[model samples]
Target: MSTVEPTATKRFSFMDILKAPLLIAIALIIALLLLGEYLSPGFASGQQILRLLIVAALMGIVAAGQNLVILGGREGIDLSVGGVVSLAAIIAGNLMGGENSGIVLAILGCLAAGAIVGAINGIGVTLLRIPPLVMTLGMLGVLQGLLVVIRNGIPSGRAAPGLSQFVTQPVFLGLPGIIWLWIVIGLAMAFLLGRTMLGYRIYAIGSNEQAAFMAGMPVKTTRILLFVLSGMFAAIAGICLLGYTGSSFANVGEQYMLPSIIAVVFGGTALSGGKGGYTGTMAGATLLTVLQSILTTVNIDESGRQMVFGATLLLLMLFYGRGKALRA
Candidate 1:
């Protein structure tokens, strides 16, 4: 049997588009956008869509790291993303003190802190043979505790004026800085996954770890690098979140942990790993964000939304759990 791959041709028939996960995700995004507009007048306005896109951009940034780790195989995931994001935001807030002069240093500090946490996680998983789920989950708790110690159970600090402006004010093409940043990230991910040696090796490991190892790939190091990158991406999101909200809080990023994963899966990245890309994740993030907004517009309370998210994730996990058997 021959597989009609989506990428096999530049042109896709309607049936082919329907069968492609990435295309499905994009279609869902458009459908949801229109749905939102139907539910609330002006919801699909250019300005409103841009605003929602910024929110999706933040989620996409965080999911970017998750995408890579999952792509690296070995059940690799970063459950600690929310904690890393919260920690980075708090630390960046303190470092920035709302001053432009401190912006660069705050960014450096947050990225470094996130990278260290990621390095430890990578070492634990890659070298110590700790399961990715267990390792990242444990790190989440540690980071939460650390946040308390750092802020003494109180949320403090402010995003620099410049930072806030970047996130909220138009910078280029009438889009905020975060949108531009997200574009850069998406482009970079495409290049890394499509053109780089590291990208090929990552895909190789994900497809078959034992075979990759036999082929002399540095599997462990690549996995470690993926986690490190994940941490850094989460940190960047944290920084952007701080700017968007204009304040730093202990639990500011608490909401993103599962959503990041959801975005990755919804974007058509299989939780079982070995097949996915940032493009799908971007569409997933946008669709999720728009769907959430529509839900809110319809008066779904926070708890209700949480339930929906939880249920969605549960269903996906169950499906993926049987993926191999299904394929067989």
Candidate 2:
């Protein structure tokens, strides 16, 4: 009877600790929304809320990929995601040429491009023993340079009409089709991370790569695959951005890089790796979106917004960074 009581207490304590971050994110989201409502009339109205969710969905999509790489450990990070996103959007735009007929091809091309870039990063990290950060940072520069050469300072084409409509137009339950897309993708990613052997291996490797390798896990391959997947997700996000903006521009993805990282980290995912999931990332994304809306409603200028954003990220990093250091 005493043993059983201790076991139950341990289990309950573990569950509470596991749920704490997600609960905090949810609470923050609600608090921000309430604040928005107080500061601006109609701030919490259905339409405005839906818009915020839509934006959050975009960030969540990108963060989903970042989550995977971070989960792969070895200081895995994809700084090239922004460049891949920009390249994918530009390619998709040019390929689609404002026509629905080529949308499929455009999408495939963007994904392929992303995969190739990711593969390069993987090779550098795994085969050449290059650091992940350096490899990805170099890739980012290369991709940006290539994009500039390709576009020659002038980008062309527009988003396909159908694609644009799908993203912006209302669909089921008055939500935009893009929101539905995000939900579907999020569910799939959740299932992949939570219910699959691959996910198990990823966590194992992230927890301790040398130990995982000794235990016969395919550490190198898994890390490479994670990078590839991250690139693909970034490409998908770029495609969505194209739909949202209805045009492509150089460095269009510049805005997403930090936000995606922030979303992942804010969701309790460890930058050192192996300690978080997409669920928390989703909540974090929503929280950031709502916070942005609140700031905008309060008429915060661009410089003020950037200052607040940086300060917030710094604080979160300190909070989580300490935990990571302590654990180490």
Candidate 3:
């Protein structure tokens, strides 16, 4: 009977769940929200939380593309996302020109603009063997210069009235339409990662490029497409931003550049790639949003907040880079 006893299969425990990044991020968000409430009586009210969530949604959308690039591996990082965001906003503002009729055209124009820049980055990284950091950093400078040139004595464009309303006004169940849009994007990303052949290919290349190529996967194309998608996602963020602010400026996107990366990393998407998902990123974005709000409540200035964020990011980089897996 003892000899006939079956060996046990390893089962995940509650302790493992406690160590999971997504769960940790959620816990942090709750803790920070409570801290905010303690500091400011109305800080954690449902309306305020909704507003913060909308902001998180914007960051998450941009991080989605970052997710794809990092997942495709090879030290992939997009420093030019800020630049792309600014550029796309300017382009979108111009195309939309304060009219609803132009919304469709603006979306297409922004996507095209973003795709071109992404394609260039992809070619540089894969074909020319330029490092992702160097390539995107250089592109960022180029994009900034282009922004300066394009804005030469010209003011940024305005959002259509309908567009602005969709982003800022409550549309369904006391939530703005943008939040609903975020929901849709999140679902789409989850499906893409879990159910699509391309998603599997992305993980394959990200995990081991050489192995993926040997296995007959189109590694180069996948990587390139990842960057393109990243750019397009940035473009979407820019468009939403224009609607949020009702107008665009040359420097509007610069603020979001670093935050986008931080959000992705915080969301528990591995910096080393091949081992994370969007669910963690959404949580991470919310965590950052809540933390920043709490800091603001504590009277920390913008610079102080930036310093905290930098330190937090540094710690996270080390943690995820070294920890590798969710283990007790």
TM-score of 1: 0.90
- Which tens-of-lDDT digit does each residue in 284-304 have in candidate 3? 888888877777777777898
Across 73-186, the per-residue lDDT of candidate 1 in tens digits comes to 888789999999999899889899989999999999999988998999999999999999999999999999998898984458899999999998899989999999999999
lDDT of 3 at 302: 85
Q: TM per model? A: 0.90, 0.91, 0.89
Specify the highest-TM-score model's number: 2
Q: How are the candidates ranked when ordered by TM-score, highest leading?
A: 2, 1, 3
Tens digit per residue, CA lDDT, model 2, 1-328:
3643221122222353356667778887887788788889899999888889888887888888889999888888989999988998998999999999989999999999988988889889998989999999999999989998879855656899998988888978888998998889877876676667787787778877887799898888888899999899999989988998999887999878878888888788888887777777888889888877777778778999878867866765564435524553
| Candidate 3 residue 86 C-alpha distance from true site, Å | 0.6
Counted clashes in each candidate structure: 0, 0, 1
In model 3, the Cα lDDT at residue 219 comes to 86
> Deviation in angstroms for 197 in model 2?
1.0
Candidate 2: list runs displaced more than 4 Å: 1-18, 315-321, 324-328
lDDT of 1 at 230: 94
The true-versus-predicted C-alpha distance at residue 273 of model 2, in Å, is 0.9
